[model samples]
Target: MARCGSKACWFGLGMALGAVVGGACAMLVRTATQERVLRQRDAPMVPSDATADQALTVDATDVVEYRGFVIHVFCHALGMGRFKALCDIWESGAVVLEGGGPPTTHVTAEESRSAAIAWARQWVQRNG
Candidate 1:
């Protein structure tokens, strides 16, 4: 058998190591993301010890027109005075698409609304 000091040997070793490490990193990321989503989804929508005020200062949902489609955005409260967004895209009063963003909560309902609108705009550009 030949010696193990060739470039091919090192390349193979590097590739194998990279694959193992990459797989591990990807799994870790996926697990963490799932855990985060679960925690955020299951937690309280508002703080328990906070004063009795509305979670949102404005209406929870609104509809706007964009790119010849209707975009309905809803802001949902998260704990610690944060918010996330859910969106619905409609054409002819029937939904064409829908999505939600939870891991990206904002400090205000308006902010969440803006983020949802931006996301909807990009989605429209890409898929509509």
Candidate 2:
């Protein structure tokens, strides 16, 4: 112990410093990874302008008017078969069916243009 200026002392000090730096870097990387994953996975559940009290599903059928036009309204979640019926009615009746969506089918100009007009007018009056 008279003079402890050996190569072992320098190596030990360097090893300890390297371990501390590496541990800190690993922690930083882990935190950044977690944050990025959460940001990408956790999208907002509700619409931006919608309030907490707003209803999630609103059906247009409640106010739909089934007058002489035999009108049908296909909403956002309505299936393709129903949409097809609406399209058929449109093509056949050639009327003015109101409303459209991702796979929506509206009344065409064939079947009952007057009926479609009456249906739309009544629906808007009732719903709006």
In terms of lDDT, which candidate is strongest? 1
Off by over 4 Å in 2: 1-4, 41-128
True-structure Cα RMSD, model 1: 9.2
CA error at residue 71 for candidate 1, angstroms: 0.4
| Residues 66-86 of candidate 2: C-alpha lDDT, one tens digit per residue | 434344532221222221112
1-128 per-residue lDDT for model 1 (tens digits): 64668899989988999999999999999999999888755365556755532544345477889888888887766666677788888887788886644348788778888888888888778878
Top candidate when judged by TM-score against the true structure: 1
Scanning candidate 2 in windows of ten residues, the lowest lDDT window is 80-89
- TM-score of structure candidate 2: 0.33
